[model samples]
Target: MRPQRLSDVVGQQHLVGPGKIIARMVAAKLLSSMILYGPPGTGKTSIASAIAGSTKYAFRKLNAATDSKKDLQIVAEEAKMSGTVILLLDEIHRLDKTKQDFLLPHLESGRIILIGATTENPYININPAIRSRTQIFEVKPLTLTDIETALERALTDPERGLGKLPIKLDDDAKRFMADATNGDLRSALNGLELAAQSTPPAEDGTIHITQAIAEECFQRKAIAGDKNGDAHYDVISAFQKSIRGSDTDAALHYLAQLVAAGDLPIICRRLMVIAYEDVGLANPPAASRTVQAVQAAQQLGLPEGRIPLANAVIELCLSPKSNSAMVAMDAALTDVNAGHNGAVPDHLKDAHYAGAKKLGHGNDYKYPHNFPNDWVKQDYLPAGLKGSEYYQPKMNGRFETQLAEQYHRLRKANQ
Candidate 1:
């Protein structure tokens, strides 16, 4: 019921194609435990099964969600009896500590070769101990052409497919099914089977499948994402990074993915953070615009809200990036954490009350407005930290460049 050869596996050519990592390992019979991660129905299980079949290894499939520790024991025992066992663990991201503890020894001993399959990002969900022992390959979504090919294979193949039935599917119907499934071959195949089986045969004993039947069989494919899962974080992270990296195209792509996932609040918050943290003083206006956009998104809500969010994302991505403010804050924090708590200069201390003048507060504090250019050379920092320069703005954008120039001129004049 699944692909027996790597060559027959649809999509994920990056891992299973000729001369690819999986193909090379299989060809050399040098199998290693690995994790296949991606969206649902992307051949994770099929690829694992194919590897097991090709290598002639005893294959066992277990669902991490339902399978207990005893199931792992059985697999381990079987592996001990029969050289090695290829264990395909589904929902591996949900693997508990107890199961991980039980499986680690067998994995290290080569008695169990784990093929972990997860719809979540393993790096974010799986235990590092388990992850370190296996190679991780991301299986991509199947293209429409790939889905069509698989559908065709299922339609004509006699033994495991629907070939036994005299079914006639129109070209448009095939395209509809392939496109409707949204790169999920399993959905496409299931829909095909449904249409073939449910439709009554005509006088010629041939079951006719039309686009309407295909649509009825399969609903629109839901967006391949969970708002609270690894995909959510991954997409948001990509969105922020793309904006920071100033890749408008990539930023928009990730933004769309998040919007499709319906996590508008998270996207809005992340955009605000990106504007200030990444786009900082380089374009202060961008940061203000990002705040306004987030406010607009909050007020407008979904569907319409995405408009302002998109505007903010594109504007932030195009804006000049500068991390000098972040760097400066971090540098200051580093000094503070490293026991640099020098007392504030007496003159700089608050001296609002009448008695405060007796403590030398504001005794010699020079008012900058009283001097030429509205600036004055004064030791503002505590004595020991007078010359310590935490903020060194980069000449990246017009605003930061002007600030940097003024900063240097002030430092020189003060010296």
Candidate 2:
């Protein structure tokens, strides 16, 4: 059931709590268009509706991906008559250019206090025009305590929630629902409803929702998500760490958990990242194979796709790990970002132009390929960073060891 007041909304205290941004905005009567982004069942819709209810404004909810431009025009027309209307635009990231252009002027005039909602990150997926005009607020997953509170509220509230029904939710069943939901309050409520409706009324006319009933209502998700879904982010974090730590068993365990949750894309993407970020230059070939494996997994889909993914995960686990490449690149980036850049040497500058010789470009440049060893030592870095070194080989793998030997030899030759 949707909440009519912010007080009834669960979790997301950072945005809706009494001194928070949303609360402060509503208090000061200075409502600005904002975006609420997070995973499913995080109360993004509830907050939007609650704000509208509290402000006594006409609340309109529409999916940007499914609703037509005419649907938005209807809301705009209503806003024109009502002075201001609160619109909860779901899947705002999918809003097309035409619909966005139509809504832009209304948002600008404060006639439509748009509350855009999406599971995707607004900064990455939303159009710049809409994003620039709206404030972005992240709705966090509901905690177990938060879910329990909502469940209890639903059980007792006579209106909106299932209160009139004689439902008895056991403590174990309530906890099971909360833990199984993985912070998704909507899933928990839906599962509870299914259990309540499916179970036969007891002799006392009470619908008993026991732990077994909860499990049965949840089906495969109940048992499979027992260990994984409760801590989805934790499982993902542990999955990468286990691989990086070379714990093949632990890594595979987490992989299985992610698969059970049906998060193939996240698994594939994370595996690719782990290949480069964790099992990096120490074994370049392994990293390359990980990318190929991710591509194969994407094509194959789950079940069969998991086969190549398993191979990649195991190889990455056993592969030698080195962050030397990542570290070196980060070091260079840090300097560049901090404005450590200096003027390039004239000899190293482009010398293909007609007046190159006159400008002293490439005049003193030595052609390394023409030298005795097919190499020549020269200042390639800018004058201020002439002796700067970034690449530090860990030499964990044979390939890196050999490369390190050659690298040190060349440095010695120059010295």
Candidate 3:
């Protein structure tokens, strides 16, 4: 049967469930720009389609990976005129920066209710401006139970369903199907359909799913809808975990997998960010080194880039690890998110610009150079966070130990 309604959606109740954010938005007819993010076959496109089918608004679809900038401009023009377009941009991360910029003004003006879809992390892959304007909801893979329910529905439903299939799915067979799919619902259903069509019928007119047959079916299974699909997240997770577990070899292996599979440069850049975030100051060198490595790769291109990348990976794995910087950054972000924004202290404001000094910029600013060792204790943070420690160094290596020593000396002298 056509999966026409939310009730028909096999999984992702987390998004479509009663009183959930999307469901609430739908019920209230309060649609906003949104991005549905998840791995392939988790129904990103299907969900958009369902929303379009159910809502009163106009729906437009385009694959950013293949669509030209001109095509996108036309869609934006249409959206501007209509002002009711639910523009579903599939593979939105593939759009070049210029193509992305084309949509920014339209999004800002509320001409289109953008429903972007991506198998990649939107925060990492999407243009920051477009992403900022949209609400993101992750659609999770279907559970085995959900897959089984989908199978049953497929077998029983009339239209768009597996019709008149005389098949007996033994426990082993069903387990094989579910396990093979790795929570991909479309895969499970397609596999079931293949088994029904190919397996010969017995005297009872029912097909038996034996282990031998299952293996053969799996080997010959048609390429799933997503060729370069679910593997993206799986590989990235492996790379991050390997680095976390301090397995340089494994981390490099995953990196090679992505590079071999044609992952985007920005994806690598994001992982470098994680290198700083998860493996910061403990290995203060990691972030900077990773940044340099990415630049090298970009400049050298492919085969040659692998060398610098390998070196960077080795450095990161061996370097002492700490997440203190990440902790501090996150805490600072929390303050900003909570509207704890404080204006730059007058003394900290720039004085070189015209009329800046007239506005008291840098007025009464202490000349620390005149102090002993060109060092002096002073308030650096905003008023509310003054003297509030953010970077608490973990004493493990040269950088952190030096930082800790400085903090200790500063604290004692100030006291």
- Residue lDDT tens for model 2, 56-123: 99999999999999999999999989899999999999999999999999999999999999999998
Runs of candidate 1 exceeding 4 Å displacement: 220-415
Candidate 2 clashing pairs, residues 3+ apart or interchain: none
lDDT to native, each model: 0.87, 0.88, 0.74
Clash totals for all candidate models: 0, 0, 0
lDDT of 1 by residue, 363-392 (tens): 899999998989988888778787899897
The TM-score ranking, best first, is 2, 1, 3
Task: For candidate 2, give the lDDT of residue 388.
Answer: 76
lDDT winner, 1 or 3: 1
Sequence-dependent TM-score of model 1: 0.59
| lDDT of prediction 2 | 0.88
C-alpha displacement of 168 in model 3, angstroms? 2.5
Model 3, 1-415: lDDT tens digits are 4355555677888887788787778788888888999867777777777777777667788898898888877877787677677789998888788877787777877777788999889889888888889999998877767777777787766667765666677655665565456677777777788887898999998877664465467662211222233444566777887877789899889777756544436346656876786678776667887888888887888777888888887787777777888888888888889988788888888998899888998886888899989877666677876666666778756788887898889877764
> Candidates' TM-scores?
0.59, 0.66, 0.52
Could you tell me which 10 consecutive residues in candidate 2 have the lowest summed lDDT?
A: 220-229
Best by the TM-score measure: 2
Between candidates 2 and 3, which one is better according to lDDT? 2
Provide the lDDT at 230 for model 1.
41
